[model samples]
Target chain A: MAETGQILNLRRYRQLRNAVVVWLTLVVLGAFLLRIPRIHILEHTARNLYFHVPMWFTLMAAALVSAYHSLRYLQSGDPIRDLRAREAARVGIFFGLLGLATGIVWARFTWYLGTSLWWNFDPKQSFVVIQLLIYGAYFVLRSAVEDPEKRGRVAAVYNLFAVVTMPFLLYVLPRQMESLHPGAEGSPAFSDITHPIMRLVFYPAVIGFIGLFWVLYTQRVRLALLEQRVEMLQATMLEAKS
Target chain B: MKTWLRGFWAIFEKDIKLELRARYAINMLLLFALGALVVMAFAVGPTPLSARVQAALLWTVLLFAAAVGLGRAFISEEERGTILLLQLNLRPGAVYAGKLLVNFVLLLALNIVAVGAFAVLLRVQVAWPGLLALTLLLGSVGLAGATTLLSALIARAAGGRGALLPVLLFPVLVPLLLSAVEATRSALLVAEGWATAADELLTLTGFGGAVITAAVLLFDYIWLD
Candidate 1:
């Protein structure tokens, strides 16, 4: 408990949280207001590049953070590291789902316009769904463990294993297939399709959303720590009375 | 090295003896695979199927059958209360290697029966029997590696039902599955034979190698914990 106060800096978190709010607000404004060259299918929905792609970037960032914390937990046996890992993954999954939803909508409007198809089994989209299921299983694994310490260790190990497999899901296998997503074979990559001006907003949006993930993750960690503290207090009080 | 091999052989022999005597896990796995194959054969009754479809169906049956039966090795150990005794007597690496060998053998047996049923029912024409065998061997390596470690993890978790096994496994297995399906399809189609399917075979080999190494390294953490 000596390190409880040191685990999170409330003032710093608040500052970053406020900055992220303002930054993302500007990003959304920039996404819609700024004019860019329109491709055939992706006329105005090119704006989704700012919103949709950033969610995956944030998801990947959060996954890396989660895996890092899990590795640390394994090495040090720190429950705080485990808690951070779980919270990071929880937020990462939120972004992954958002990425998936936005991808579906983006695909429906742009590519699958004439046909009534929400999911046509784009390789990238399918892989992302599998990625979400893996994280979903992580949450299930955590809930299935009764003891907090054991849960942390077991969940941390699973998290690390999942992260190790992510490169295959996100990169190797997807690249081997024809994808509707940018950067695939036969598809124009970001450099070709995306206007340079869009990168100005897209990069910032990625940073902003990742910052937002950090804020949300920190808040959850703080709430969880408080709950843990209260449980310890109740246990101690019961012992004293008995 | 010698001691490790000896320990692994002991565990492997013990499992084989138990499997021979009870035959519970293997029988259930075989029956499950047979039932699924029959239903699949009936569902696609008398229709001409593409090589891709046949390959996909084969791997799907293999994957699901594995999902159902592969966890029994670890789960049974936990259930029988011999896990602690085994833990005390053997190194985790040896235990993992032994279990992986056992699971790999079981998966091969299941694959043989399933693939046999699949070929006969669907009237599969194998252009390259050697390539198909190689694909199955590589695919089984990755599948066995993944399920064995995950089964150990699942066995320790409360409420870790049999259902959770596939949920955790399928995602990690996507790369291997994709390559396996492709290689198998190529083998059946007689398209470009070994040359074109070489990429997929390489991917399968790499995936199996990497996963097994990771499992060996990580098994200690799961076992000791």
Candidate 2:
């Protein structure tokens, strides 16, 4: 705890946390209150653009941050970089799950409402699950290793492979398949049809959620550092006694 | 340049000879493939599933077979404690190339047995055998190269006692698998749209190249460490 006090800048963390709280509050309010031009089927749920889509954008940002840290870890062999990479992925997977859950609910109420269907294996939705499975493998890979240094190096390398597969899995493959999700070349695209009026909330929602990711990621990093310090102290105390 | 090629050839030949002598990977993979084929047939019965489902099943079995076989490349070396010896003898890059080549060739051959058995047991028929063959060839290369590198990563960690390989390999191979399944379906259909099949074929080729390129570029770091 004392080591955390020395290592972490409490004032900056507090300020960032406060700002994220305020920003997300505004986002939630705007998401519900703001007027969106109603499309035929989407109706009021068109407001989901503000929340559901940003979850993916935040996920992508988190992936980029995780990959960046993994690259740095490989370059410098820095344990701190590995910590940042792991924390980013952990938070990223959290956002991915939320995105998937929200998407399921949104699609249920909208597309499959009449049929009582909850999960339809839409191309994008199915692909997202595979993407999550890849990240889950990273966690499994980490757990199977006993040494911290070997775990970090191997995990970081595997993390790089995970990131390289992201675009092909999520975007390229999904778009190639027939699906109810957006962005087929022959159809009237979702991005094309979205009301410019919704962009007002949509852009801010993306930024706010990403800020929220940053705050959560920073918190995890601090906690991990504290745990490392505690372990070090325990080792020193045992040495002293011996 | 001659020495590099010589080193790669020596490692590759050594791997093949060792694998052939032991017959560990090939026997298990062939048995697994036959077992999966028989089970799928028994479960679904000779009902002749839709072309898409059939293609999906074929690719799924192929992926699993690769997972079971390719994962042993590094694991065996480590278990015998010969990985360190090999590392000291050959360059990391050469060792990587050798392992990948061995995996790619073995997987390609294994897929042949799987697909042949699949066609025979299920009474499956394809309109374009050439294209289907091409698809299987390209897809196997992509799958093998990627899995070989991942095998090294996992072997170095857990000593090869986990489901990490399949879980990791599946998602990475999704793009390739998608293209393969689509192309296979088209080949099995009576349709003659040559130009349309080009997209799937091109995607498979592009994906295979990309995976191999990435493996070549990154294997050194994974190998040396």
TM-score of each: 0.96, 0.94
lDDT, candidate 1, A40-84, per-residue tens: 888888898888988988888988899999999989887899989
Over all chains combined, what TM-score does candidate 1 have? 0.96
lDDT for each residue of candidate 2 in A49-140, tens digit (9 for 90 to 100): 78888888888888889889988988988788889999999998999999999999999989887998998767777776876787788888
> For candidate 1, lDDT tens digit of each residue in B1-225?
888999999989999899999998789889998898889899999999999999999899889989998888888888788989988989999999999999999998988888888889989999999999999999999999999989988887653587889888988888888889889988997655799789888888888887888888777877885
Candidate 2 chain B weakest lDDT stretch, 10 residues: B191-200
Which pairs of residues collide in candidate 1? none
Interface RMSD of 1: 1.5
